[model samples]
Target: MTQSAARPAGRRGQRLTYLVKRLEMAERARMEEVLRPLGVTLHQYTALSILEAREGLSSAQLARRHVVTPQAMHQLIATMERDRLIERRPDEGNRRILRAWLTEHGVQVLKECHRAVDDVEERMLSRLAPEEAVAFGSALERCLESLTVPPEGLARHGDRTA
Candidate 1:
């Protein structure tokens, strides 16, 4: 059993996984509230941010980066394309491969969202010193590294039963 499962039910909240899950839910809720007025969901905002940093990503690549399925990314890309928030063009060498990029309007919207997100982040980290904030982020990264495993390895170990 997991460490958290070993704990008494009433004290489960004190476990790392429970606390992390709670924090993720609360943060997502707050982000949704703040981004709703801007007419963009957190996932869309994240896609825009990713496109900003790495232009010309395929829908499949974006899905992997976003930790979502390719079908979901395709739907999201279609909606964003319809709204003119993103533009998709065939790759130069491979006509079958479509690359996505943010439009001017999308960039402007992202700038506005950045300000609002900054406010939320500032408020969330207000209690922490700068060093503490950095350390906390590093710790989270370490936890993520520990949990992540190669799919091939999972198959080799027959751990995919669930």
Candidate 2:
């Protein structure tokens, strides 16, 4: 049998997912190392970035954006709050709804983290030409779009409330 046919059908379907997951783990590890001095994990850094662009997001909203369970986000937010990186307050209109916003310190730390992470990203993409980088980004977006369901009753990226 040819090499292609010799491989199990299940393994073929797993190849892409496996590679993507491995890349994600490697990227997270690199980010974790770079962000260690800032006392932030990849998840916290992501939350800070999200809050920087759009403040006052409810935990549920943040959870959806991060593709994490609400329970997981709750723990993350609580830790960030304790670290004074973010503040959580009840919405003025809805007392039951808690909104999260970055503190000034959070913004400052996030800026520093951005610079560090940017260096990491640059190193990762150094081999790709500008056009190739753009193409790769577009391809990743296409893959994400294919896997994600359309957000309903939610603001898209740039439309997020500040």
How does each model score on lDDT? 0.85, 0.86
Query: Which residue pairs collide in model 1, if any?
Result: none
Cα error of candidate 2 at position 25, Å: 1.6
Per-residue lDDT of candidate 2, residues 26-52 (tens digit): 888899999999899999999888988
Using lDDT, give the best candidate's number. Answer: 2
Stretches off by above 4 angstroms in model 2 are 1-14, 149-162
In terms of lDDT, the poorest run of 10 residues in model 2 is 153-162
Q: How many times do residue backbones clash in model 1?
A: 0
Q: What is candidate 1's CA lDDT for residue 64? A: 94
